[model samples]
Structure formats: C-alpha cells, structure tokens
Target: MTQDIWTLIVVILVFLGILALMIRGWRNRTRSQAGLFDSLPEVPAETGEVVLGPLTGVYIGSTVAGDWQARIARAPLGHRSAGTLTAFTGGLRLDLADATVWIPRSDLQTVRRASALANKTVPGGGILVARWQVDGPDGTTEIDSGFRADDKDTYPRWEALRGDAAPTTRPDTPSSTTEENK
Candidate 1:
C-alpha cells in the first residue's frame, strides 16, 4: 500500500511539472513576440447590424503578415477559439468567445484562401485568411488572421469582396447562405 501511494504521488508530480513547463513556455513565447502583437481596434457602434454573416467557425490563429511559421502569442489574438465572422461597413468583425476583434476595411490589405496557419492545417484552401494592418510595438505591422468557416462554400463569396481595396461601405452579399445577413 505504501509503495503504491508513493508511485501515484510521483506520477502526479510529473504531470504537474509538465503543466508548469507548458505555461512557462507560453509566457516566454508571448514575451518574445513583441512585434507580433498589437491592440485590436474597438468594433464600431453601428457594427451591431451584421451586413453579412456571423459565420460560425474556429479562429485558427494569426501570424506575422507573411510568415506562416511564426505564430502570434498575444492573448485572444494568439489563442484559438470557436469564432464567428461578420461583415460591416467599417470592416470584418471576428468574434471569438473570449473577445471581439475589429478589422477595419481601411486597414485591410487583402483576403485570401489558405491551407494552413501556425498551429492548424487544413485541405488546400480551407482557411479564409484576412490580411490587415495594425499598430504594433514596432509601428504598423501586417497580420494574417485565419478563420475556417463552418460552410466552406462561403469562402468564394468572401474572397470575392476584394478586401485588398476594401470598400468604404458594406458591400452587398453575393447571395445568401444558411447564415443570413444578421
């Protein structure tokens, strides 16, 4: 009985040690990724009316604009969450369970379909990636935020909007889907 109890305790301690190491590593990564994170712009008040959809999906993650391998380590921005994407005149709003992020059209660079991000990978063109600019610790930095929509077909419609020259007003939806223009 005594030997069994000691073995159980040792196993628990090892698992606890691993957990601590993970937390430490995450913190270190966040601290070192100075230029990778920036304060997200607040969503506009009028954005309450979703022009397109609150498309359900997972917020895969974001990385430095053109660097796929360098994962961002900022909270909410770096963290993965079940998310929704909505279109508004101001820009595309990504709502994660943890927080709401606004990607203003003015800051938008382009919209593209991709297969992978830093921590997640899908088929050849499964991800809807939005490239935009944000004020960063090192001035303005471009970021690529990936969202994998529940309805994969929606990607073509979204990609058609021309986010590189994002419109000043919410553009008309190409057509409808299970998700309405909320």
Candidate 2:
C-alpha cells in the first residue's frame, strides 16, 4: 500500500509540473503578443445594416497572415470558441462566445476558403478565412481569422462577402440608385 501511494504521488507531481510549464509558456506567449492588442479595432457602437449572417459556426482563431501555424496569442485572438459571423455595411463582426471582434470593411483584404488555421483542422475548404489588415506600432499586420459554419451550404454565401457583395463602404449614394439613403 505504501509503495502504491508513493508511486501515485510521484505521478501527480510530474503531471503538475507539466501543467505549470504549459501555463508559463502560454503566459509568455500572451505577453509577447501584447503589442498586437492595441491594433485590434474597437467594437463599433453600431455595425450598420446586416449584409449577411447570423451564420452559426466555430471561430477557429486567427493567425499572422499566410502562416497557418503562427496563431495570434493575444487575448481573444488565439482561442477557439463558438461564434456568430455577421457582415454589415460597416464590416464583419465575429461574435465569439468569449469576445467580440470587429473588423471594419475598409480593413478587409479578401475572404478565402481554408481547412487549417491556428490549431484547428477541419476538412478541406471547411473554413472561411477573412484576411484583413490592422494597423499597429509595426505599421500594418495582415491577419486571417477562420470560421466554419454549422451548415456547409453557408460557405458560398459567406464567400460572397469578399467580392462585389461586401462593399468596403456604404455608398453615400449608390450610383445604381437615383438617390441613395445617407
């Protein structure tokens, strides 16, 4: 009985040590990412008219643009959570379970299809990647945030957000219409 107790204690100690190390590593990563926190845009008081969404999905997380593995470790950026993606005349809003991320329309670069981003892996073309730029102390950083819809059919509709469908700005007066709403 004593021998078993000693072995169990040793195992527990080892596990706790590993846990501590992991916590320390994550803390360091968050600190290293502090600079990026300022670059994230402030959530708008209003997001304007909804152009698309209330699309249900998992927010796979964001990363330095083009580097699928380099997850942004800043608070709220590097974590996976259930989320709703909405497109508005103002831009895109990621209503994450834990945090809300607002990306202005002007910041959008493109929206693409992807399978892997940050630490999450889904099937090919399972994720919608919104590539956008954020201004920071380092000039501008382009980042890609991934979202996977619960309904697969929603993918194409979200993709439309990248093209002519997602206008960067609400037209003061849409040329198509005789008089656009201000």
Candidate 3:
C-alpha cells in the first residue's frame, strides 16, 4: 500500500511538470506571433504587379492617431523577418512570414520621414513609415508601414513613388547623416 501511494504521487508530479512545460511553450509562441504580426489586417491577393522591390524589413504594426506605441515584445529583436512589399495600381501588398498586410492606395494617408518608428530606430538615413487605414471586422484602424530597405538611402526613391503625398522635407535628423560617415 505504501509503495502504491508513492507511485501515485510520482505520477501526479510528472503530469504537473509536463503541464507546466506545455503552458510555457504556448505562451512563448503567442508572444512571438504578436511581435511578428501585431494587429495587421489581412493581406490582399497578390496580382502579377511589380512596382516595389521584394524589400526585406522589420514590420512593426498598424499605427493609430494617438501615442499607441509598439509592444516591447514586438520589438525588432523579438520579431524580425524578411518581407516583400509589392505596389500595385490599386494598393500595396506586404508579405511576411507571419502576416500579410494589404493597404489600398486610396487609404494611404501620408508617407512621412521618421527617425524612430514604433520603437525600431532606422539608423542611417531614417525610415519612411506610410500611414494608411483599413476597415475590418475590428472597425477602421490606421496601419503604419514599418519597412526599411537594406539600403537606407533608397528612401528618396520610395518617396517619389508615392507621388505628391510624400513629404517634401527629407529626414534631416542628425542621426540620419551620422551613419554615412562610417
């Protein structure tokens, strides 16, 4: 009887241990997914259009009007992926490993020059974050384009692509020019 009791306790303890490990893994995966995709809306179907490079960048999340910042877990360190941004005649399509975000050009509010966007700092010449709105089941939400090309200096070309909506003033931040010297 004593040996049976000890065996039952050991089995219970082993089961509890496995449960704890499973919970930990699930939490970790949830955090990683949030970091990668955040609250981006669904990506539209990819047409055979080719406008922008299959540029790889760290996609943060959709931007709201207020000071809604990116979650710390969603920082570049935790969430980083090589994604492609394709510009179609109708809208822009962003394809990442974790999420797909499609924004119609009509919804594009403005393309601005940012020193730091959603906690991620664009070192060399800063980065351009395009703000757009999408109407979804969660209502209308503004999305921030968190794309920084491998070549930081290519922002001007991207700005031109946006036509007159792009900001006329270039990012003249001190840090923007600092990296060029290196």
* lDDT (Cα, 0-100) at 113 in candidate 1: 87
Cα lDDT over the full model 2: 0.76
Tell me the alpha-carbon RMSD of every candidate: 9.0, 10.2, 10.0
Q: TM-scores of all models?
A: 0.79, 0.83, 0.54
> Candidate 3 lDDT, tens digit per residue, 68-105?
24322333223555666666656667777766666666
| Order of quality (lDDT) | 2, 1, 3
**Shift in Å, residue 152, candidate 3:** 2.2
Rank ordering of all candidates by TM-score, starting from the highest? 2, 1, 3
Q: What is the C-alpha lDDT of each candidate?
A: 0.75, 0.76, 0.54
Best by lDDT: 2
TM-score, cand. 2 vs. native:
0.83
Clashing pairs in 3: none
How many backbone collisions does model 1 have?
0
lDDT of 2 by residue, 1-182 (tens): 69999999999999999999998998898887675547578878887999988889889889876567778888678788999998998899999987899888888877778877887777767888897777765555667798888887877777777633232222221223111111
